[model samples]
Target chain A: MKSAQRTTRRPLALAVAALVGLPLALSACGTSTAASSSEAVTEISVMDYYNNEPDKSFIGDALTKCGTQAGVTIKRETVPGKSLISKVLQQSSSKTLPDVLMLDNPDLQQIAATGALAPLSDFKISTDNFAEGVLSAGTYKDKVYGLAPTVNTIALFYNKDILDKAGVTPPTTWDELKAAAAKLTAGEQYGLAFNANPTYEGTWQFLPVMWSNGGDEKKIDTKETEQALQLWTDLVKSGSVSSSALNWTQADVKDQFMAGKAAMMVNGPWQIPALDKQPTLQYGVVKIPVREAGQTSVAPLGGEVWTVPQTGNKARQAKAAEVIACLNSDENQMSMAKVRNTIPSKTTLAEKFAAENPKLATFTELIKTARARTGELGADWPAQATKIYTAIQTALTGNASPADALKQAQGQ
Target chain B: MSLTTDLSQTAAPSSGKASRKHGRPAGPPTEAQAPRRRTRQRRERIFQWLFLVPAVVYMALFFGYPVVKNVVMSFQDYTTATFFTGEAPWVGLANYVTVLSSSLFSTSLLNTALFTIGSILGQFVIGLALAIFFQRKFPLNGILRSLLLLPWLLPLIVSSAVWRWILDKDSGALNRFLGDLGVINTGVPWLTSTSLALIAVVGVNIWIGIPFNLTILYGGLQEIPDELYEAGSLDGATGWKAFRHITWPMLRPVVSVVLVLGVVYTLKVLDIILGLTNGGPANSTQTIATQSYDLSFHEFKFGEGAALGNVLVIISLVFAVLYLRASRRAVDE
Candidate 1:
C-alpha cells in the first residue's frame, strides 16, 4: 500500500516541480552576457524610447550611421515612451545600464543628479552655437550631461479651412483667442481644444500661456499665473472649449482638430508630418497666443537628449560620446530637423532650416524664447509640474475658482 | 548493539504507535532488512524535499523578494538616486506619515473603496443573473455563453481604449444611441465628468469581470444535482423559491470565492483606469493603486509609493484572512 501511494505521489510531485520550474528556467534564460572589457569593444548598446514608427526608423538610421563612424556596432533597444525611465532605473540598479541612453530633456537633470550619466565635458564635446534653452535643459549642477540634435515647442495650430470659412484669422492675443473660439463654437465642433489632463503634458501645454503672461514656475500662485488660469477657466466655462479638455492629451486635441471637431489646437511641430499627410486639411501654425498683444510667446522647450550612461567602461563611454556629438553635428542636425519636423538645436542651423521650411518658422521662432521646464527648478520641476496640472484640472473642471485652485495646489 | 536492534530503536516509536491500532504488529527488524529499510526511508525524505525545491526557489525569487523589498523600501528615503548609488537612508515611517497625511490620500482611499465595492457588486449580481439564464436549456446557449467571455478575454488596455471611444462625449456610440432613442438631446460626459468618471470606470471593470464570475457561478450551478431540484419542485419550491432554497445555499462556497477574489483583483486595478481616464478630470477617478503609481513613476517618490503600496497590501490581507475564515466555516457547514 505504501509503495502504491508513493507511485501516485511521485507523478504529482514531478508535475508540480515542472509547473513551477518552467518560468524560473525561462527567467534565467533572459540574462544576456554583457561585453567584458578584456575583449576589444566591438559593439556599444544604446537604449531610447522612440519605439514608434518613423521616429524609430529615423533615429535608428542616425544611430547606425553615427555608430559606424565611431568604429562600433550599435545594439539599440527601444521602449515605449512612458516606460523608459522605469527601465533606466531598473538598469541602473542592476549596473546593466546601456553605454548610450536617451532621455527626454526635462528628465536629464533628474537622471544626471542620480549620478547615472557622465558629463559630456569629460569627452571635451563642443557646445558652441547651441541654443541657450537647449543647453540649459541638458545642464545639471553646472555640468552638461546630455545634448539634443533637434528641439520643438508647442504652438497654436489652426484649421485654416474652418477659420477661412468663418473669416477669422488666427488669434495672436488671449482676447482675440477667446473671441475667435466663442465665435467658431457651433454644432459638434468646439472653438478650440487643448490638453488640461493631470500629467506633465498638460503642464507643458499650459506653460505657453502662463510663461508668456509673466507667470513663474518658482511661484505659481502669482497674479500672472492666476490670470492665465482664469483664461483657461473662462474658455472652458463659456463652452468654447470642451469640458472634455480636462481628459484630452495633446494627441487627442490634434485628433479633434484633424477631424474638424476642433477649430484649432495647442500642439507642437512634431504633429506637422501627420498634418502634412492629409491633403484636404489646410492648417497654419503660429506662436501660442499671448495674454496681451505686446507679450512675447514663451513656450516650453520640448525634445529628447542623448547621454552616455556610467557603464564603467571608458572606451565604450568615449565611443558613445562620439556618437552623441556626431548626432548633434550640423549636417545630421539639419537633416534630422527636416525629416523629423523639429528645429535644430543649434541657433544658426535652426535659423537656416526655418528660412527653408516656412511652415516650421513659427515653431523655430518660439524655440528662441522657449523656457526649459527644468531650467529654474531642476529635478524639483516634476513636483511643480504636478501642481500646475492639478491646478489646471481643478480650475477647468469648475471645482474651484482659478485663483483658489492655484492657491490650494501651491500649498499642496 | 547489532544493526537490527539499532534500526528498531530509531523507527519504533515513530512508526509503531500509529500502526499499533491498525492491528499491525511492531516487530523487530532483521539484520538484512534493517539497512535497506533505513536507506529507503532516507531516500523517500530526500525525494520529498527535492520536489519542494523548485517551488520554494520560485516563490523566494518572485513573490518573497519583491514583497520584502517593498516593505523595507517604505521605511527608507528611496528615490531615483537610490537606484544609482544604492543608498536609501532609513526614515522610519516618515514615508507612511507623509503619504497618509496628504489630501490626495483620503481621496484615493475613498475612491478605492468605492471602486472595489461598486465593481464587485455589479459584477456579482449581473454575473449571477447571466449564470442562471445560461443554466436553462436553450438554442445557441453554448455559443452565447462563450461569446460573453469576449470582454474578459480582450486585453484590459484594449478594452479601456475601445470604451474610451465608445464613451466619448460628442461622437460616442452610447450618446448616438441615446440621441436616436430621444432619451437625451445632448451627449453625456460619461468619462470626462468629475461626478461620473469613477462610475464609468467601475462600469467598465464590471464588464471585464462578468465573464470570470459567470463561468465560476455557472460551474457552481451545474454542480447541483437534478434530484435536489426535482424534490424542491415537488415540495412547491419553484423558480425563485427553489433558487433561494437550493441554488444559493448550495452555491455559497463558490459565491464567497468569487466575491473575495473580485474584491482583491478590483482593489489593485491599474491598467484600465490608467487607460480610460488616468485618474483624471480633476482627480475624480484616482484610486490608491493609481496614486501609488503616480507617486513612483511621475513624482519619483519611491518611498511614498512603496508605503502606499504596503497600505493596499494590508487592505488586501484583511480580505484574504476573512476569506480564509469564511471558507473554513463553509467547509464545516
Candidate 2:
C-alpha cells in the first residue's frame, strides 16, 4: 500500500514539473533557433528610427542599394524616435544587437562608450572628407565608430506672404529680430514661434542663439548665456512670441507657422517636404540671428549616423561595414542630401548639392559652420543640455530671471 | 417540518456532542476500507490544489519576479554601460540616498500629492453625483450611462492628444470659444504657464478618472436593495435623510475600494502628463512616476529609477493595507 501511494504521488509531481518546464524549454529553444539560423552570411539586419514617411522610403532605398553593393540581403527594422535608445540597450544586453545600427548624432557617444560598437578603423573604413562636426559626433575617445552621409541644422524659416506684407526682410540681428517680431504681432497671431519645452529639442533650438552669442556649454552660467536667455524671455514678456512656445515642439511650431498663426519660426530643414506640400504657403529660409552684426551664426548639427554593432559575428560585421561605407559614398551622399533636404557631410559635395538645390542654400551655409553638441563634453552633453533647457523653461515661464535661472540651473 | 427539525438538530450543541460520541460506531469498517477511504480523501485534496497551481506559477513569474529584480537592482550601480559590461557592483543604499536627497525629490513628492488629491476629490464627487443622477429613471438612461464611458474606453494617449489640441492657446476650441464670448482678449496659456499647468493637468486627469469612478459607484449603488430605501422612507426618511442613513452606511465598502484604487492608479499616472506637458513649464507637473521614468529611460540611471519606483510602491502598499483593513472591518460588521 505504501509503495502504491508513493507511485501515485511521484507521477503527479513529475506531471506538474513537466507542465512548468515545457514552456521554459520551448522558449529557450526558440531563441536558440533564431540565433543559429543567422549563421549564413547571405543576410544582415539593420535598425534605425526613420519610421516616418519620405525618410522611411528614402532610408529603405539607400539600404537596398547598399545591400546590393555588399552582396547581402538586408532585413530592416525601424522603431519610433524616442524608444530607439532603450531598444538598443535591451538588444545589447540580450547579445542580439542588429548588424547595422543607426543612432542619432548626439546619442552616438553614449552608445559607443558602452563598448558595444566596433570602431570603423577595425573594418578599414576611412573617415576622410567627413565634416568635422559629424566626425567628432561619431567619435569616442579618438576612434570613429560611426558615419553620417547627410547632416542637418535649424535656420530661420519665415512666411513670405506675411513678411512681404509686414515689410520685414527676415531679421539677421537680435535687435532687428525683436523689432520685426514685435511689428508682426497682430490679431490672433504672434510674431515668432520656437520650442522651449523641457526636452532636448528645446535645448537644440536654443543652441544657435547661445553659441552665436559666444556662450559655452562647459560654463553655462555665463553672462553670454544669460544674455541669450534674456532675449527669449524678453520676446515672451513683450508678447512678441507666444507663451505657448513653452509647450510647442518643433513640429508644433511648424504647424503654427503653416496655420498662419505665426509669421516666423526657428525650425530645421526636415520640415521642407511638409512645407512644400502646402502649395499656397510661400516661405523662405535664413540663418538664425546673431547677437551683433559681425558675429556669425553657429547652429548645432543634427543627423543620424550608421554604425556596425559588435554582434560577435565577424563576417556579418564586415558586411555591415561595407553597407555603411556604401551609404556614405560620395554619390549616395549627394543623392540622399538632395532628397532629404539636408546638406552632405562631405565638404566637397556640399557646394554641388547646394547648387543643385537652391531652396536649401541657407541650411547648407549654416551647416558649414555648425557645431556638434557632443564635441566638448562627449558623454556629458546630455547633462548640460538638460541644464540649458531647464534654465530656458525657468526664465520663459517667469519662475526666475534669466541670470538667476542660469545660476540656479547650474546649481550654484 | 423535517428540514426544520434537521436544521435545529444540527444547530444544537447536544446533537454535535452526540455525533462526536458516535463518530466511529456506525462507520466502523475493515482496515482495507479505511485506508482506501483515507487515500480517496487525500486524492480529492490534491485535485483541489491542482486547480490553484496555474495561478501560483503565473504570479511567481509575472509579479513576483519583476518586484524581486527591481529590489535587487536598486542596490546596484546599474547604468547603460552595465548592460554591456554586466558589472553592476552593489552600492548598498547609495541609489536611495541619492534619489531621496536630490533637489527634485521634494518637488516631485509635493506634485504627486497635489495631483492625486486634487484628481481624486474631483473625480469622486462628480462621479458620485453622476452615479446618483443616473439612478433616476429617465429617457435613454441606459444609453446615456454607457455613452458616458466613452472617455474611459478611449486610450489614455489618445485622450491626452485630444486634450492637448483642445487646450492649445491659439487655435484651441476652448480658447476660441472664450474669445468669442469676450471673456478675455488674450488666450489663457493653459499648458504653458507654471501657475496654470498643474491645474490644467489635474483637470484632464479628473476627466479621465470620472468614468471609472462612476461605473464602480453606480454598481455599488445598484446592489443596495430597494426594500431598504422603502423601509427608511416609511419612517420619515426621504431624499437626503434616506441617503444619509441608508446609502452612506451601505456604500462604505465600495467607496473605500474605489478611493484606494483611485489613489493607486493616480499615483503612477505618467502617460497623460507626458503626452501633454512632459513635466514641463519648469517641472510644475513632475511627479514621482514621471521622474522615475526619466531617470531610467531618459538618463539611463536604472538603479536610481528602481529606487524611486520602490518608493512609489511603498506608498501604494500603505494605502493598500489601509484598504484591506477597512474592507475587513466592513465585512465583520
Candidate 3:
C-alpha cells in the first residue's frame, strides 16, 4: 500500500513542478534583449506642438497623408502649447528622440546650447525662402535647427464701440496712449487691458517703447526702457487700466473687451477669432502703434521650426528630411495656411496665403516688425517672466516704485 | 535530562494511553505519545508562521527594499533618463546641496508647513466637537453621522475643481453673490491673487479631512467607559468642563493618530494645489510635491526629482519614529 501511494504521488509532484517551471522558463525566454538591424529602416518619431484639437487634426491629417505617399511611415506625437520646450527637453532625454520636432523659436538657442538636437545645415531645402528675420530668430550657433513655419507678430485688438465712446483713435505714441487711456478712464470703463502677469506679452509690450526711444534690451537698459515701464505702471496705478489687468490673462482681456469693459488691448491676430466669437461686440484689428517717430512697429517675432530628431536609420532620416522639404514647398504652406489660419513662412507664399485668406494679411505685417525674445530663460521662462507683471503689480498696488521694481527685475 | 525522561516516559506509555485514548486495543509498533501533543506543536508552528509571513513579505517588498534603494539613489546623481543610459554619475551630496539651496525647496517647505498646521488643527478641533455632539442617542443621529462623511467621500479633485468654479472671478457664485450683496466692489481674484490662492487650496483640503476625523473620533468616544463620565457628573463636572476633564484625556490617543496622519498627508499635498492653481501667480502656492513634479516633468531633471522624493521619505520616516515613540509611551502609561 505504501509503495503504491508513493508511486501515485511521484507523478503528481513531477507534473506540478513541470507546470511551474514551464511558465517561468517561457517568460525568461520571451524577455530576451533583441537588437535591431542597422540596415533596417530605423523608425523616426516626430513631435508637433499643435495642442489645440483643430490644429492637431490639421497637422495630423497633412503629415499622415504625406507620410503615406512617401512609402515610409512616420510616428508622431503632439504636445500642449503651454509647455512645449519643457516637454521636448524631457522627451529628448529618452535618447529615442523624434527625428523631427516643433520647438518654440526662442528655445532653439537653449536647445542648441544643450547639443541635444541636430542642426539643419545638412538638410536640402531653400532655407532662404524662409521669411526674413525668421532665420535670425531660429538661428543659433550659426546653424539652423528649425524651418520657419510662420511669421507671427503683435497687433492691437480694440473694441470699436469702446473706442468710439471714448472718441479716441488707437494711440500711436507714448504720450497719445497715456492721454487716450486717461480720457477712456471713466466709471469702470478702462482704456486698455494688459497683464502684469509676465508673459511673452509683457516682453512684447515692453520692447516697443524701448525701440521707439532708440534702445534695445541687448544693448542697454536705457531711459526708454525705464520710461516705457513707467508709462504702463502709471496707467495701471492711475486706474485708467485696471491694475487687476496686470493679473488677468490675455484671454481675460479678450473677454473684458467683448463685454465692453476694456476699450483697447495690445494683442495679436490670435484674438481675432476670439473677438469674432463675441456676437455683441464690434472690434477692429490694426498694427501695433508706433512708439516714436520713425520707430518701426514691433511685436516679438513669433514662429516655429520643423527639424529632424536625432534617432533613426540613415534611410528613414533621409526620408524625414524629404518630408520637411515637402512641407517647405508652396503647396504645403498654402495648405497649412488654408487649414490652420497661419501665415506662410516664405515671403512669396506669405502673400499667396494672405491673398487666399484676408485675415492672414494682418499677421504678415506684424511678422515683418517682429523681434524674438532671448531663450536663456528655459523652462523657468514663465516664472521669470511673471516677475515683469509682478513688478507692475507692485507699482500699481502701491507696494513699490516702478523704477525699483524694474531694477529688481534686471537682477532677477 | 528533560528530553530523555520525557521520551522514556512516552516510550513506556506504549501500553497505557494509546489503549485508553484510542480505545481500540491496537498493537503499538514503536512508541506511544501524548495524542494532543503533536497537534499542539504543529498548531503553534503554523500560527507563528502565519503571523510572520504577511509582515515579512510586506516589509521586504514595500518597506525594506525601498528604503535601501532610496538611500542608495540619494548618493548618486541620477534622473529617469539615467535608467536607460545605464550607470549614473556619482554626485555625492551635490544634489542634496542644490535641493537645500533652491528657492523651490524653501518655498515649498514653508507652504507645506502652513498647510499642515492649519489643516491638522482645524480637522482635529472640528472632528472632536462633532464626535461629542453625535455621542448622544439623538434624532437622525445615525443619518447625521453618515451625512457628515460626504465631504470625505467626495474625491479631492472633485472638491478642488468645484471650489475653483465657486471662486472664479466673473462667473463664480461666490464673487457674483458677494458683489450683488455689495459686500465687495468687484470679482475677487481668489485664485489669481498670490496671497489668497494657497488659503483657498488649504480650506478645501481641510474640508475633505473632517469626515475621517469625525468617524474615527466618534468611534473612539463611544468606547470610553460610561462610569467614568457618570462619576464625573456625580462630582458636579458638566458640559465643556466635563469634556475637558474627562473626554479629552481619554480621546488623546485617537487624536494623536489623526493629527499625525493629517500632518503627513497635508505636508505632501500636491493634487489639491495643482488642480486648483498650479502654483501660479509667480509660484506663490508652489509646494514640495508640485516642485518634484515640475523638476521631473518640466525640468526633466530626474536626479533632482529623486532627491526631492527622498526628502519626503526622510520626513515621513521622522514622523514614523515620533509616532512609534508616542504610541509606546501611551501604551506604557
Candidate 4:
C-alpha cells in the first residue's frame, strides 16, 4: 500500500509542475497568439479604429446575432485603428492573421497589399447593393476585398430654435452664409462654429467650403480656396468667432451647440445622438452650403468596410462575408441605425429606414451629393493631413497667410 | 619545479615574452602559490564565461542580428508591396544619401541635440541644488525627500497626463491659479505654439528628472567625507570658493557618472513625447527618438529607422567613453 501511494504521488507532482510552467513558456512565444480550443468556436478580430468602447459592445452584439444565425460560437477581438495596420503588417509577413478584419477607409490599401486578406468578391450578396462611393472604397484596384457595413455623410447641423429667433434662413451660398452668420452673431453665441484645429476636425473642413467655390490645394491659385479661407478668417476678424478657441475639437463645437451658444456647426450625422440629448435646443440638418451657384451641396462620407484576411480559409472567409451580410440585413441595419444615428448602406433597407424614420430619410436625401476625400494611396496621408492642418492653423494664427500656408503644404 | 611545470603547461613562449614588455620579472618556480593561483584563475575563467553567455546570447538574437538585417534592408527600396511578401529591390547607398541630405533629418538632429543639452544641464543643476538642500539637517527632511521623489516614481504616462492638464490653456488649474495671482491677464497657448511646445515638454522632462538626480547625488554627497570640508575651512575657505575647490573636486567622479547616465537616458526619450503631442505642432519637437518611431512604425521604413537609432546609440557611446576616461584619469591623479 505504501509503495502504491508513492507511485501515485509522482505523476501528480509532475502534472502540477507542468500546469505551473506551461502558460509562462507559451506567453514568451509572442506578445499575442491564437490558442485553438476544443469545442466548436470561430474567432473574429474587428478594428474599432477610433477605440470607442461603446462600439465594442455593439460589435459583440452584432457578432452574437450573426453567430446565432450561422449556428457557430464566434469569438471577437478588437484593435485600435492607428496601430492596427502595423500589427497586421507584422502578422502578415509571417502568414498569420485573424480570421476576420474590420478595415477603416484609410487602411484598406495596406492590408490588401499584405496578401493576407481573402477577397470578398465571391460572397453570396451582390456588391451593387451598397452605395457607389462606399462600394468603391472597399475595393482595392479591381478587387473587392471588403463589405460596406455602415455608410455616413457630412451635413450642416443648425439649431432650429436659434435660426427662427434670428429670422435667418440656412445659407445656400457664400454671401448668404456670411450674412446669415453675421445676423446670428449675438452675445456669447457664435454665428457659426468654424474652429478647425488638429486634423480630423479641420482638414477637409474649410477646404470643402473652398472646393464648392472652385478652390483646391492642387489648383493653388484658384479664387475658390482664397474666398473660402477669407470667409473663415473674416468671421474671426469680425469677432463673430474667437481665435482663442481655434484649436477646438468637434466635441468642443458640440458643447457650444448643445448650450445654444452656436447656431451653425458643420458635422456628420454621427453627432445626432449627442445633439438630440439637449433639452433646450431644437435642431435640423441640411445639405452643406455650396460656394458656386450650380455646384452640388457637397459633404464628406464616413463609412466602414468588413474585410477578411487572406490567412483565413476561403470557406471560412465566405462564411464570414455571409455573416457580415446577415448583420447588415434590414432588421440588423435598422438596429444599428437606431444607435449609429447614420444612414444605412443598402438601397432597399435604406428605403425602409427612410419610410419609417423621418430624420434618417432627411440624411439619405443629402447622401445623393455627398463625397469622400481623395482615396488615401500612401500611408503618409494621415501624417500629411496633420501637417496640412497645422499649416492652416498657422494661417489662422496670423503667423502665415493662406498663400503661404498652401505653399508650405505644397513643399512638403 | 611545480611553478615552472604549470607555467610551462599554460603559457606559450610568445605570451611569456609579451608579458615582459610591461616590465615584470620572468622567473617562475613558486610551488605553493601555483595551485591557489590556478584554482582562482580557473574560477575566474568559469565566471567570465558564465557572465558572458547571457550578454552574448542577448546581443546575438536581438541587437546583433537586427542591426545586420537592417543594414542589408537599407540597401533595398521597400514599399508596402515589397516589404513583407516579395524580394526587396536593392537601392545601394541611396537611402543613406537621402537621409543625410534631407532637411527633415537635419532638423530632427538639431532638435535632438537641443533636447539632450537642455535636459542634461537642467537636471544636473537642479539635482545638485536639491542634494545640498537635503544634506542640511532640517525638520521633515524625510517627508520632503519622499515628496520630491513623487515625480520620478510616477509612471511616465501618468506624469505626462498630469502635466497636460496643468498646461492646458483655457481650463487648466495652473493658468487659473497664476492669473488669480495677477501673473498674467490671459492664458498662454503653452502647447499649441510651435515655439513654446518644445520648451514646455522639456520642462516636464526636467521636472521628472529632478527627483532621480537628487536621490543619486544625495547618496553620493553622503559618501563624501565631512572632515574634507573641515580641513578646507581650517585652511580658510568658505561659500562658492570652498565648494569649487573642495566639494566639486571630491564630487567629480560622481558628477561624471551622473552626466554620462543623463546623456544616455535623454537620447532614448519617447514615452514623454508620445504622451504629450506625439512630436507635433508641426514636428517642431520631433527628436531623434520620435523620428525613429515615425519612420519605422508610421512609415514602415524600418531600415532608415534602425540607422537613425544607431546614430543615437553611437552618440551615447561616445559620451560613455569620455566619462570612463575621465574616471580613470581622476583615479591615476
Poorest stretch of ten by lDDT in candidate 2 chain B: B1-10
What is the C-alpha lDDT profile of model 3 across A1-412, one tens digit per residue? 4444554465446544544444444423322232334575535567878878777887787777667666667788887776776666555555556667777676666565556555677666568776656776666667776776555666667777778876889777777878887888776577887665534455555555555565555423346666766787778767677755544566767777777777887766656666666678877766656656567766666767777655534566677777777777778877876666566777777666667777667777656556666533433344444455445554555555767765655554
**Of 1 and 2, which scores higher on lDDT?**
1
Please provide TM-scores, in order, for all candidate models, with all chains considered together. 0.91, 0.90, 0.76, 0.80
Q: What ranges in model 3 sit over 4 Å off?
A: A1-44, A49-51, A79-94, A106-115, A151-154, A185-189, A198-224, A266-268, A374-398, B1-112, B134-165, B168-172, B185-201, B222-236, B274-317, B327-333
| Model 1 segments more than 4 A misplaced | A1-40, B1-43
After superposition, the stretches of candidate 4 with alpha carbons farther than 4 Å from their true spots are A1-52, A153-207, A210-288, A292-294, A351-366, A374-387, B1-51, B82-86, B300-313, B323-333
Looking at model 1, the pairs that clash are none
Clashing pairs in model 3, backbone N/Cα/C closer than 3 A: A98-A309, A99-A308, A99-A309, A100-A309, A196-A246, A196-A389, A301-A371, B78-B303, B79-B303
What CAPRI class is candidate 4?
incorrect
| Candidate 4 per-residue C-alpha lDDT over B57-167 given as tens digits, one digit per residue, 9 for 90 to 100 | 555555555555666667777656553465577887777776666566887898889888898889999999989889999899999999999998899999987886687
Query: lDDT, candidate 4, residue B325?
Result: 90
Report the interface RMSD that candidate 1 achieves against the true structure, in angstroms: 8.7
Docking tier of model 1: it is acceptable
lDDT score, candidate 2, position A30: 27
Query: In model 1, how well does chain A match by TM-score?
Result: 0.91
Considering the two chains of model 2, state its CAPRI-style docking category.
Answer: acceptable
Interface RMSD of 4: 14.3
Query: For residues A1-412, could you state the per-residue lDDT of candidate 4 as single tens digits?
Result: 5554564466446544544444434424544333434444454544445457566677678878887787666766677766777767767665566666776665575557656566676665567666665665666767877665667866677888889988988888777877888889886677887556644457756655765666544444345666666677677667566553455566666777777777897766777777777667688877667765678665555677777776535555555776777777877777777677767776666677778777766677655444544344334455555545656665665666776765665565
Sort all candidates by TM-score, best to worst: 1, 2, 4, 3
Query: Candidate 1 at B32: error in angstroms?
Result: 11
